[model samples]
Target: MFTLIYITASSVDESASIGRKLVEERLAACVNIIPSIRSIYHWEGSMEEDEESALIVKTSHELTPQIIKRVRELHSYDNPCIISIPITGGSRDYLEWLDDEVKRP
Candidate 1:
């Protein structure tokens, strides 16, 4: 099983930090950082908007728990968004590489 995890960060530095940790620990095969983006949503009983960095994390389903734990440990937000979506289809070679990169110990 594979998943593309979506996470929002306060800045590029934080995004890099999160991505680095996940890759270093082999929790994610890869992490793509979108440096700047506008975000709008409800928070603390009110709607808010801000500029944020987005992290697109790629990993196997088996490592989600560890990934979530590590992300929360490093994240600045009291409640950061960490959502996962199933990867139903993808290139065989790329998917194989992903599997090899995030193999469970």
Candidate 2:
């Protein structure tokens, strides 16, 4: 199974760093970084807003746990936003390519 992990980072540089590490380590096949995004949420009983970067990681289900753990280790926020969504369907060629890029368990 394939999955997409959506992670929010403090800045583009940070996002790029994390993304690159994941790809280099074969924990992720690819990563798409959105340089800027506006985020609003509640934290520690307070509402907050900030500009952040969004990192979308493509990998396999088996790698999701390790990805999350690694991201937490590299992240700045105490509770970073890391959410994984299953890829139920996609182009067969692309999926196959992704599978090839990442290591299998």
Candidate 3:
């Protein structure tokens, strides 16, 4: 089973660092880094806004837990955003490629 994990990081460096780590560990097939995202949310009873980077990670469901754990360990935020959405459909070849990219040696 495959999944799309979405996470928001406080800075571009953190996002890139995490992306590199995941790909190196075969925990993620690919990670798309989107920069300069504006986020507005309530925190500590106050509305706040900040610029953030979004990381869209492609990986298998079997690796979600480990991915989440690593993200939390490396994240700077007190409560970082880590969400996973199951991939219900995709091209067979692309899916196969994703599988191969994340496979352990």
As for candidate 1, its clashing pairs are none
Once superposed on the true structure, which residue ranges of model 1 sit more than 4 Å away at CA? none
User: After best superposition, candidate 1 residue 73: deviation in angstroms?
Assistant: 0.3
Error of 1 at 24 (Å): 0.6
lDDT of 3 by residue, 62-89 (tens): 9999998989988898789999999998
TM-score of each: 0.95, 0.96, 0.94
What's the lDDT for residue 64 in model 1? 88
Worst 10 residues of 2 by lDDT: 96-105
- The best-first sequence of candidates by lDDT reads 2, 1, 3
Winner by lDDT between candidate 3 and candidate 1: 1
- Pick the winner on lDDT between candidates 1 and 2: 2
Candidates in order: C-alpha RMSD to true structure:
1.1, 0.8, 1.5
lDDT by candidate, in order shown: 0.94, 0.96, 0.92
Model 1 per-residue lDDT tens digits across residues 45-101? 999999999999999988888889889999999889999999988999999999999
Question: Candidate 1 at residue 27, lDDT?
Answer: 93
Error of 3 at 67 (Å): 0.5
Residue 29 of candidate 1: its Cα lDDT?
92
Best candidate, TM-score: 2
